[model samples]
Structure formats: structure tokens, C-alpha cells
Target: MELQLGVLGVGHLSTAILQGVFEHGVLDPGSVLLADRDPDRLEDFAGLGCPVVPSTELVRAPRILCAVRPQDFPAAAAELAPLGSEHLVISVMAGLGSDSIRSSLGGACRVVRTMPNAGAVLGCSMTAVARGPGATDDDDAFVERLFGAIGLTVEIDERMLSAATAVSGSGPGWVYLLASAMHDAAVAVGFDSQLADTKVRQTILAAARTLETSGQPFDQLIEGIASKGGTTEAGLRVMRENGFVEAVVAGITAARDRGDALGAADQ
Candidate 1:
């Protein structure tokens, strides 16, 4: 609560984070300043009693959270260029590296980059934090604390952040895709749409809980459910024959590669 935070954008990810922090009592609404190009987006925070400030005045807070889209960073950077050495800037913009952010923000502001998924809305995000040049231990701990309010936090080398972006940041979408496929398949096979949706949702939740508590490798878990010549085996065999696992690996790799490409382009 002692930290006076300034948030420069209120897009989906930022909105989730702010909602989590406020819901969990991690920070008081009154201590945070919010800003966004779209006034409608700021209305939620404003309703929560968080002060809305102009982007140019974000530097007034010692710790600034930059959640702007990567394409919009240049203009946001111009407004934040006045940040001094004492300021710490936490960025959630995908594919924008710390070096690029620091240079654009007057070359003195401390930068910490993080990737948190939309799960933060319910305080279950798996956030990855990477400390940047000139960021102190205190700064790193502060970043961890802020993200910990939403869920678990992992500190990783900045070089691996792109991989983290693919695995955790975009991981939810992949799961949803699989769930949707299963739901539609159930409906196609004669279950009512509502029943298929409910069953699929429960199945996913149960499987996730089992995976967390099983203490076994994924292959072993899969093998347990798939007996020889059984129904599970039949479905799994078709998936294997159709390159399901390979497709998943390739998809994640492509996402990581795209993130790298975006960062390179920014540089």
C-alpha cells in the first residue's frame, strides 16, 4: 500500500491485473493512478476510486506500470521519457525488450519486464518476470510481490522471456482451443449443447486437478487412462496418428519464434 503506482494502459491484461490486485487487497485503489487513450477503459478503475491521470504525468509515481500495446509504445515512451534514475518501470508489453524500453525512456529509468496471462482476472496467472539492466534487488522483489498478488511468479533469464511468452502468456488460448474442440465433438455426437459444455468444462477442471496432484510424468498419466484396445486408446491412437502432439509442439514453437521476430523488429 505504500507504493504509489501509475498504470499507463488499461487493456485486457492490465485490467485483469488491476482487478486481481484490488480484489485480493494487495493495493488500495486510491494509491494507484490510471491512464489510457480510451476513456471508457479508465472508467472501471475510476469507479474503483483510482485516480485517472494524464499519461504525461505518470512519472509522478515512483513505480510505473506500462501496459501499452507494443505498436503504441513509441508515443507512450515519448510521454514517459522524463523518468529519472529513481523510477522503476514495469512493462507488460509483449515483444518489447528491456533495452528498447530503457533507451526510449530517457536511458535512466529502471525496467522490469513481465508476461502475465488473462488468468490474472481470477488470480491464477503464471507470471514470468525478468530483471533488466540497472534494476536493483529491491526492484526485483517489488516486481515479484506485485505479480504474486495475482498468482505464482517465476524469475527467469530475460533471454527466455519469449519462450515464457509462448508457454504461459499464450498457453491459455491453446487450452481453450482444445476444450472447444472437445465440446463441439461432444455436441456432434448427440449430447445437447448445454450438456456438452458442462461436461467438457468439468472434465477439463478435473484433469487439471489430477495433473497437479498425480505426481507423475505426463506420459505415465496418459498411459494410465489409455488401456490397450480400450475407448481411450482408440481416441488417443487417432490423435497420435494425426500428429496431435507434433502439432502442439510446432504451434508453441511458432509462437515463440514470432515473439523473437517482433522483438528483433523493435530493436
Candidate 2:
């Protein structure tokens, strides 16, 4: 919701981010500034009504958002080093660390490290943010407002970011995977492709709503639909026999560990 928004990379994620900010009414097109070395990106931004400048100039804005690749972070930080103490930085890069940024930008400048999934483009994202070690409550609050504009905002420890990245940061893909599977299953069960697609979407939505509002235990909720000799129970037994629950647990754990590995790989 900050008017003085400066973005470092005008790539795919940056475009989605700017679009989300506008669609969510968090920012106006005229108020957002962007910078990137890529001419194609600048041209695209121009069409979107965003002011695209050189990367160095973007850093001069009061609040800068870094969306560049991890390898480009150091260079971007160097460009932002000239900014005054009043500047605040928000980074959504996967592998970059807040400490590296705070050390790069001088004085008591504010730093925010945030991880939001690609779903932010649709204003339905779960964003995790961690402020600088020295950032006051006000600093963190402002960041909460910013990220909340895109979706949900949860303030958590930077160390926990690896796990957060696995869950919220990569949650959209997991959801899509299930959606795809459900659609395919519907089609295999004699439903037309279009019907399967439509029904699967509604099914997913209804199931999510039940999970959201139902006070009953998850096991009880599932059991409510599945009779003692029903098809659902048969499927459930197959899943259990195949270690479905364990596989899911292992998958998320692997994702969390992969995130930690990516962040630390640079060091």
C-alpha cells in the first residue's frame, strides 16, 4: 500500500506483483516505479502503466522491492547502497538473506524479507515476512500491511522461512497438483473433459470450505462420507497401504530442506 514502490526486476514475478498490487487496490499504476536491465521487461511495464527506469534509479525510491534472481542480489544491493536511512527494502527472492542486504545498505535502513507464492498474481497468496533484526514493531507492522494487501501475512522467524517456503511459498503448486489429479480421475471415470474440469474445481472449492468451517475432526469428517463398505473407504485403504500420509510428510520435509539448502548454498 506504500505509494513509493520501487521494483528491481521487471520479470514474470515482478509483473504479477505489480498487477496484484493494482488489482487489490493496494497501489495505483502511476505510483509504482520499476527498474530492470531487460529492455523487453521495461517495454512490458510501460504497457502496464508503470514507470520503468534504470536499475540504479529504482533504488533511490523510498521503498524498494527486489525481485531479481539470487545471483543478481549482490549487484542490486550495491546499487541500493547509496539510499538514505529512510529507505526500506523488501526482497522476495528465494535464496537471498536479509543480513546480506542490511550489511550492503548502510545506516539504520529497514530491511524486509518476504516470500509469497506465484498465486499473489490473483490476490490469493500466503506471504511470510521477516523484518530486520533491528527493525522496530512499527517497521514490522508496515510490512504486514504491505504483504497483507496481496494476501495473508504471517510474521515469523527468518530461520523458519525454509519451512514456510515449503508450505505457503510452494502451496499453490501443491493445490494445482491435486486439482489436476482430481480432474484426470473424473475424466477417467467417464466424465467429459469440460465437465470434469468444471466439477473438479467446484469439488475442490467445496472441500476446502468444509475444511475451513467444519469443527469436526478431519478423520471424522472423511469418515462421515465413507460408509463401512463404500468405495471411498476402499480408496482410503489403498492410500494408507501405499503410505500416502507418510509420503506427504516426507515430501514437505524434503521441500523444507531444499529451501534451506538453496539459501545456504551461497554461503
Candidate 3:
């Protein structure tokens, strides 16, 4: 059977996306085709019952998900060039823009660029999508629904994709760093490693759930926890004095600048 969805790469992010699609029943497993240079990666997907095909066969699918790293995209695009305007191309590669994909794959295809975090593996990612000139509202909706199966989806201007890449694409690593710090702090206070890990993980999960469900602003949430002269206030004050916020801002700015440089290279 001709595939409906084609995945060009089978790396971590692509695997997460494919897992979500399978878990959500978004597409029949038999109708999805996967391609990767790594034999182990191909075997992994083959075990899940997805056909491991060549890039030539995969790109024949009506909708293609380009999940290769930015450096690997040119070769994938060359393989996909025979596809025409009917194909809807969605790329999850950071630093690769839609114009470059269109140019590399022949200008006839519709392209949508997206950034999905590692949370996609757990169906909780915050995915940001942007459309190219050839895309239509239907194309936008299709991309949104495709990513939404794996997590929350938002539409943003293509110009802001680099900013989104910094925040959403790179944001998970930042959160993990903070989690590591919290775990270390807990251990310093005499908790065992297992206990500290459990507590820190639960705390972060609870905070994220509260933020999602509560209608309160982030500052209000923080204020609620940090009573005047309380322990939370003391800790927060120490963080502020140590330029924690400034450091975070600087990190995000660096990621965004790097993304800009990559985009420039593509252009």
C-alpha cells in the first residue's frame, strides 16, 4: 500500500513523534513509512511494525515528516525532489527553514516548519509551527493536527521560529538543568539520592500541572508560594541576588543567536 505518512529520519525526536502517532492512532501503522541510515534505528522501527524503506520509497507518501538533523537535510531533500505540489512537507529540524526545504526539494511542495521538544515522547510537548508561502489554511490545520496528536500545538509567524527554537526546542534541557540543581540541593540537605530524585521530579511535575490548570499568572503563583520572610522567599531572594534570571535570559539569547546563525548558513 502507498504510505500516507513518511518519516525521513528515525532519531530521538522522530522516534518520539512516531510513538505518539502510534499511541494516538493518528495513522495506521501499516500506512506509515520510515527511513533512516542507521540499521539499528531501522530495526527498532521495524519491530514496531512500521516498514523500513528507502528515502525514495518514503517520500512517495502524501505527507512527509522531515526529522533529520539540519546537516543531513540536503541529501534527504535531493531524494524527495521528484515529489510534486501534492506532497505536504513538515520539518522538525531545528535551524532549517521552509524556504530552504522548498528550494532543496523543488519549489512545488508545501512546507511547514515545526519545533517540538523532548516532551513529545510523553505526549506533552509544546510544538510551534510556521507555514511557508505555498501552504494553505488546510495545510496549517493538517500540520497542527499532526503535531497536536503528540502534544499542544501553536501557530506562529515564520520570523519567530528561531525564538521558538530557543525556548521550546532547547527549553527541555534548561528545565532538566534546573531539575538537576534541585536534586543536588535536596541531597545536600540530607535526602538520599532516590528520595531526592523522586521529590524533585514530583515537584516539577506538580508545578507544571498547576501552571497548566490554574488560571493564575506565573508571578501570582510564585507569590503564593513565597510568603514574606518565609523559606521560599529567602531562597528566591538568594536566586535573584545571584542573577539567576539574568543567566537564564543569557542562555536563551545564546541559543536563539545560534539558531539565527544556522538559518543564515542555510540561506
TM-scores of the candidates are 0.89, 0.82, 0.89
Each candidate's number of clashing pairs is: 0, 0, 0
Q: How far in Å is the alpha carbon of 202 misplaced in model 3?
A: 3.5
Global Cα lDDT for candidate 2: 0.79
Name model 1 segments beyond 4 Å from true: 1-3, 187-195, 212-214
- List runs of model 2 lying over 4 Å from the truth: 1-3, 39-50, 106-108, 179-202, 209-217
Worst 10-residue lDDT window for candidate 1 reads: 1-10
Candidate with maximal TM-score: 1
Q: List ranges where model 3 is wrong by over 4 Å.
A: 1-3, 39-51, 184-198
Per-residue alpha-carbon lDDT of model 1 for 18-40, expressed as tens digits?
A: 88788878789988989899999
* lDDT score of residue 179 within candidate 2: 89
lDDT of 2 by residue, 1-267 (tens): 445778888887777777666666766776778888878877865776777777778765678888888888878778778666677888888877777677766655677788888767766678888876466777677667667776788888888888999988887777888789889989999999999999989988999889768999999999999999999999999979989789778888999999888878755
| lDDT (0 to 1) per candidate | 0.90, 0.79, 0.87
lDDT of 1 at 105: 93
